[model samples]
Target: MSLLADNGKTSNCRPAFVCLLLFSLLQLPRPQYNLPFSVLALFLCGVVSLSLGQNDKAQRDRLIACLASLILVTALLQAMLGFVQALGLAPQTYGWVLFTPGASDVMGNFGQRNQLAQFLGWGAVSAAYLYATGRMGRAATGSAVLVLALMMSWTGARLPLAYGLGLALLAWFWHRRVPQDETVARMARVLAWSVLALALIQIFNQQIDSVLQAIGLPIHVQSGSDRLLDAGFGARRRIEWSKAWEVFLQHPWFGVGLGGYAWHSAWLEAYGGWPKVPESWLFTHSHNLIFQLLAETGLVGTLLVVGGLLCCLLPYFRRGEQTVDNLLLISIAMMLLGHSMFEYPLWYLPFLLMLVIICTLSPAKGWTVQLSGRFRQVLGVSAGVLALAYAATGILPYRQLIQNFTPRNENTLQASLDNAKRSLKLSELSRNPLWSWEADLGMVNYLQPDGIMRDLQLELAERVARYQPFPTVLIKLSILRALNGQAEPAKQALTMAIANYPDYTPVFQHELARYREPELKPLQEMASKAVKAGAAQGGATEAGRLAAVMTVAAPATRQPIF
Candidate 1:
C-alpha cells in the first residue's frame, strides 16, 4: 500500500495546533531532560496529525510500519557503531557516541548508557516485527540481530540483558492475539530462535568475557550482570518508590502537586522517616509510573490514563481483525509497560512520542476521546501562544550563552553572568524558583562579586537549602561561612554537609585529604589559608593538618569530619 496519497482530504491544522499546546506544557522547567526533545515532540505532533489525519487507520498503520522500519535501520547503524567502538576498531568520540563518564561503556546519541540500551531494545523489537511480518529480508534481519546482541551485551545495560528471556515470551504472546495463526507460529519460531541464540552465550559467559577482554570488547561489569532484579537497583530506588507510595497513600485522591515529587522526597526523608538514600542521590520522578502519577496527579489523573490504556488495548484481547501494525503496537506497549516498572520509558521524548502514537492508534478512527470543535479552536490558539512563550523565555538565556561563547576566560565569564541575569529575569516573569536558583548558582560560579559575593552566596545557599538541602549547596554554604569568619557556623554547615551525604563524605574527605602530603602542597597551602581565615576550628582545619601530616592517606579513608 502507498503512503501519503495525492488527494488531500482534510486540513490537520486543528489537531496539529492542539498537539503543539500539549507539548508546550512539557517544557517550562530548567535542566529539562533535554530541550531538543520538546522540539522533536512538536514536530512529531504536527507530522502525526497532518500525515496520519483523523479516522484514517490504514495511513496510521502504514506510518507505524514505516517508523518501525526506521527504528530497525537506526538500530542496525547504532549497533555497528557501538560494536566498532567496543572492539576499539574505530574512534569512540566520533559523532554523539561518547564513552560514559567514568565508565568505558559507549552510548550513541543519548549520552546515557541505560537510555541507549532501551533505544536498542526498541530497535530489536522493531526489527523483529519487520522480519516476522515479512516486510524485512532475512539477511537484514540476521544482521540486525547480530548487531543487537553484541551491542546489548557489550553495553551491559541491565534491563535489556537481564530481561532477555522475557522478550521471546512477549513476542509469542502478542503475536497470538492477532487473527493470523500462521504469523503467530512464524513469530514464535523467530523470536525463540533469536532469544535462544543470545541466551546461549550464558553457558560460556566466562569464556565469552575472556575473549571480549582479549579484544578489548569486554562486557561492562556493572550492567552485564545476569542478576535478575536488583531489589530495585539497591536501596536508593527502593527508598524513592517507598516515599512516593507513602505520599500517595496520604493524598490518595489528589496526591501531591504535580512536579512536587522532588521536594516531597526531601520532606519525607527528613520528617516521615521514609528511608532516604544517602542525600547524595536525589530523585526527580517517583521512578515507578503508577506511583508517580498517584503522587503527582492523584487517582483522578491515574484513572484517566488507565482508562485510556484500556480503551486502546482491550480491543486486541477481543477477537477481531488485526494487522502487523496492531501487533507491533501492542508489543511495544507491553514492553514499555514492563520497562516502566523498573525504569521510566516515557520520560524520554522519542520513546514517549512512539508511545503516544501507538497507544492512540486503533482499528477505529480518531483518538479515544475527541475534543469539541470550540475547545479545539481555543486549545489551538492557547497552544500557539504558550509555545511561543516557552520557546522565547526558555531559549533566550541559553541562546545568549551559546551565541556569546568565547574561549577567552574574561569574555566567557561575562557572557555567563549576562545569561544568568537574563535567566533570572525570565524566572521572575515565569514564577519558577528553579530559574532564580539557576541564576544565583551561575552568578556564584562565574561573575565577580562586586562586593555582595558573600550575600549572594549566603542568600543562594539559604534559598536552595530551604527547598532541598543538597550536599553541594551545603558544602558551598560551609565554605562561605568559613571565609566570612563565622567559624562555628562553618563547622555546623560542614557537619550538615557530611552527615547529609554519608556516601559522599569519603569523596569529600579525599578532596581535603589530598592536602596532607607535600606533593599536594598547593592544596595544602590553600587549606591553610582557608583555616587562617577563621575556619581554624572546623573540619577544614583538621583535614588540612591531617593531610599535611599523613604521608600516605587513601582517598577513601574516613575521619570524623562531620
Candidate 2:
C-alpha cells in the first residue's frame, strides 16, 4: 500500500495500524522503567492519527523534520557529555538514572553506554543525510557527526562507530546525485567535512586514550571490568540469548507467554542447572530482537510482528527520487535494524515511536479521508473518555510500583503486592521483570521463615525464577524444595546453583557441604565443570567477541550462550 499522505479512503491502513499497536502493546512497557506503557500509548495514538490521514503533506514533512531534529539534538548533547567525560570532567553516576550504572562509562543521558551508542549512531546518520542534502549547515552537522562518533569510539561502542563510518562513506556517492539546481558545491563541502569528522572520530579513542593515560589525569568514574560483563559465564548477552532460545524450544508453539523473557532466563538459571545472577543487570528481554520475539510471543506473534513491519516498509522501496526525508528514513532504518540485532531497541519507547513515524511517512494515492461531522464528534468523545479511563486505571499499578519501593508495615506491604498484582493484569497478565520481581522479593522477605507456606513459597519461587534468576530466591526455592521432601529436584537445584557461582554464599556452601545425598555428588561435579567450561570458552584472547565455542560438559551447563 502507498504510505504517503493524500486525499484518500484506505481500509488497509486500519489493519496495519492495528497490527503495529498489537505488536507494541504486547511488548509490556513496565520492564523498562523509563519507558512506561503510557508513553507507548500516546505515541501510538499520534502515529495512527497520521496514518489515518488526519494530517496533510506539509504537516507530515514538518513532523518528520521535527523528529529528526529531536533525535539529532539528543545525540549531540549525549556526545558533548561523552567528550567531557573523556576529558575527565563529568561526575560519576552512582544511583539510578534508568538501569543503575554498574561502572564508569560514558553512558550519556542513557543509563547504559551501549544504548547511548545506539542513539549516537542514529544521530550521526541523520546529520549525514541533512548535510549531504544541504537541508542543514555543514559546520553544525559536521560537528555533530564528529562529536557523536568520538563518543561512540571512546565508549567502546563498536557498532555505532562502524555504522557511522559506513554511512558517511555512502553519503559521498549521494553528493553527485543531488540536483544541479541545488548547491552541488554544498554537497562536496559537506562530504569533505563528514569524511574529516569520521576520521577524527575513528582515532579519538586511541589518541585521547593515550593522552589520558600519559597525563595520568584522574578520569571521571572508571568502571573497571563491569559486573554484567565479568559476572556471567560467557559474554553476558550470549548467555542471555542462549537461555531465550531454550525457552523457545520448550514452548515453541505459543511460547512462554508475553513479557516472559526474564522469567525464562530465571528458569534457565534455576532448573536448567545454571546459577542465578547476583548483579542487577538482568536480561529482561532477549538481546537479539528476533529471538526475544520468538521467546515472548511465540510463532504466531513473531509472524504478526514481521508482517506488520513489512506492511509499513515495503511501500518505501518502490522507485522514487532520493529526497531528504527518504534519506533520513533509510539511515534511521539501518541504525534501528543494527541495534535490534544485538540490543533491545524496540523496548526503548522513543526509538520505537521514531520508527513508527519513519516507516509510515510516505506518499499515498486518493483523497485523504478524515473522520468528520457529528460522527467525528462522537468518535472523538469516546476516544477521550477511554483514554482517560485507561490512563487512570491501567497505569495505576505501574505508578504504584514505581513509588512504593520497600514497605514493612503489613498494610503497606499488602498494598504494594496488590499494586503489583494489579499491574500484572494491566500488563496483559504479564509482570515487569524488574519492578514486578521486586514486589515478589518483598513478599518473600516479609513471610516468616519457619511458618512460610510451602505451596505459596513454591509458587513464588517459580514466578521469581521466571522473572529473574536471583540466587537468594533460588536458594530459598531449593531450601523449600528440600523441606517439601523433593530430594532429587532439590539436589539438582543446589548443584546448578553451585555450578553458576564460583564464590557462593557461606549458607549455600555449608548446605551443599552438609548434604548427604550420594546421588547428587556427581551432578554437583558436573555442574561445577560446566561453569568452568563456559569460563574457559570465553577466556580466549580475543577482545569483546562472543566466542562460538561450546563445551562438551553436562547438557545442563553446556548450552551455548545464544
Candidate 3:
C-alpha cells in the first residue's frame, strides 16, 4: 500500500503520534514519572478505535505482511546460526549484531544468546504467521524449519520454543476453518510438519538422551539446571511484596510521590530492620510493577493504570483478532513479566520508546482520520518541532553535568557547588526541595578540606543543629574543631557523639588519641593552670568548685602552678 493510502485509512496514526510525543517527553533528561505510561494508554485506545473502523483494512494487512517478513528474516538468520553451532562450526560474529547469550553450554555467552533467543522468538511468531498466511515461499519455509530446529537445540530457550509449538498446534487444529486458497493450505501443511519434526527432535534428543546414556550413545547434552531451580525461588519476591504492602499502608493516599521508592525503602529499613537498607543498597523500585505502582502511586493511581490496560485491550479482544494480535501481545506480556523479576525496564527511555512503537503499530485498527495535504505537512512539522524541543531539554542538563564534573573545570565545579548550596538554601526557605540534594554534598567533598573550611564548618554546625546527630558527621565535626584549636569543645562533642553511638568505640578512641599529642599536652597544661588560678580567686562558687576539682585532679608530674 502507498504511504498516503496507509495514512488515510489506518487507525494507527493517532496512537502512533501520541506514542511519539510520549517517547520524546520521556527522553527529556528530567523525571517524567507516569506521563509516558499515561500517553501510551491513550495510544492504545487509538489503536483499539482504528481496529474497529471500517477503512484501512488493505493498508493494515500490507503493513502486517511487511512486519511478518522482517520477523521471518531475523528468525531465519538466528536459526541458521544455531544450526551452524549444532554442527560444531563456529559462526562468524558480526560487530553490528546484538548477541545475547541463551544456554551457557549451548551458547557460550549467556546474555548475548538470551537476546538472540528473544529476537528468534519474535521471528518464530512472525514466521508462523507468514507460513500460515501463504506469504512464504517453499524454499523459505524449508529453511525456516531447519533454523527453528537449530535455534531450539542451540539456545535452549524453552519459552519461545514452547510458544512456537503452541502456535503451530493451534494453527493446525484450526486449519480447516482458514481460507480455502491452495497456497494457504500448503503453508498450513508446512507449518504442521515443521512443528511435528521440532517436537520429536526435542523429545527424542532431550528425554531419550538420558536413557540412551546407559548404552553410551548420548544424543543430547544436558546443561546444569540451577537456573531452573532458581525459577521457583519465591522468598525474595514475597519479602519485597510484603515490604511494598507496608509502604502502601503507610501512605495509602497519593502514596510517596514520584522517585520516592528508594527513600521510603531506606526509611522502612531504618525503623523495621529490612535487609535492603545500606548506603549502597539503593532500590529505586519494587520488583513487581503492579506493587510498585500501588506503593508509589497509591490505590487510585493503580486503578487508573488497570482501567487503562482494560480499555486498550477491549476493542481488539471484542473483534476476535487474537491470532494476528498474539505475537505483539505475547512480546509485551513477556517483557513486562521479565522486568518484574529484576528490573524497572520503563526507566530506560529507549526501551520505553520501543514499547510505545510496538504497542501503537500492533492491533491493526482503532481511530482512523484522513488528513489533507496541508494538514499532513503540518503534522510532519509539528513532530519535528516536538522532537527538537525534547532533544534540547535532555542535552542541556547532560552537558551541564559533564561540564561541572570534568577535571579541568575545577572552577566550574566550585561555582556549581555554590549554586547548588544557594538553591538548597532557597528550597529550605520555600519548603520545596529539588531531588538532587546529594549534588551539594558531592561538591563539598570535591572542594576538599583546605579549599572550603569555613563553609564546611558553618554547614556542619547548621546540620548538627537542625538534623538528628549521626555518628560519622559528629566524628568529622570533632576532628575539624580539634584541628582549629577548639580542643575543649571538640572533646565535649566527641564525648556526646560517643555516648549517643557507643558502637563507634574506634572513632572515640581515635579522637582521644589526637588530644594526647606532645604539642597538645602543653596547651592542656596551660588550660589546667588557668582553671587552678581561677579556683583560688573564687573559692566555693559553682565555677570555683569545678576549677578546684580540676586543680586537685592534676597529676604531680605535670608541675601545677602556684
TM-score of each: 0.67, 0.69, 0.51
The sequence of per-residue lDDT tens digits that candidate 3 reaches over residues 1-562 is 4432223322334343443334333333323342333343333333332232322457656766786687677667666555444434433455323233342234423234444455554565566567667676667766776566546544654444454455565455434444454444555566566566556655555564466556864235431221335443444455456667778888886566555565455334333333321122235576667777778767765665555444444434443444543434444345444544444655444344434445544453445456443444444455556656656765744444444432233458786676656444433322212213333332323322223565565464434322223454444555556556678755544433433333343433443444644434533443345345434757434345334333312222311110
| Pairs of colliding residues, candidate 1 | 516-547, 516-548
Cα lDDT of candidate 1 equals: 0.56
Model 1 bad stretches (over 4 Å): 1-55, 88-95, 161-166, 174-180, 213-223, 227-233, 250-252, 274-279, 363-441, 444-470, 474-500, 503-562
- TM-score, structure 2 vs. true: 0.69
Model 2: how far is 508 from its true place, Å?
Answer: 3.8
| Candidate 2 global CA lDDT score | 0.56
lDDT of 2 by residue, 1-562 (tens): 2223233343234334556656556555433332344435644554554444444566766776666777788888887766555554454444322222344467776767777877877776667556655568866876776777666665655565445555565454444465452433353455356446655645544455566677885443322121224444345577677778788888786576555676566446545644233223345776788788788777877888787667666555454534556656766776787778778777776777666666556443323344333443344456667667766764755555554434334558787685556434434322544345456655554333234466876777766665555556555666666666677666555544443343443345454444455533543444345445445555322210111111211234474554
How should the candidates be ordered by TM-score, best one leading? 2, 1, 3
Clashes of 2: 12
| Residues 1-562, model 1: lDDT tens digits | 4223443323333333344444444333322221344344555554444334443556666777788888878877777666655655444456445554455555665666666776677677777677767888878777777667656665656666545666666555656666366665555565665566566543455677687678966553433555445543555566667777777888787665545576576555434534333434556676678888787656765776566566656675555645546666676676677677766767776777676666546443333343343444444455557667766787765654433332224548785676666544543433444244444444333322223667766766655554455656655665556556566665555544443344445444444453333333333343344334323333344343333222212122222111
Error of 3 at 36 (Å): 9.4
Task: State the lDDT at 14 in candidate 1.
Answer: 31
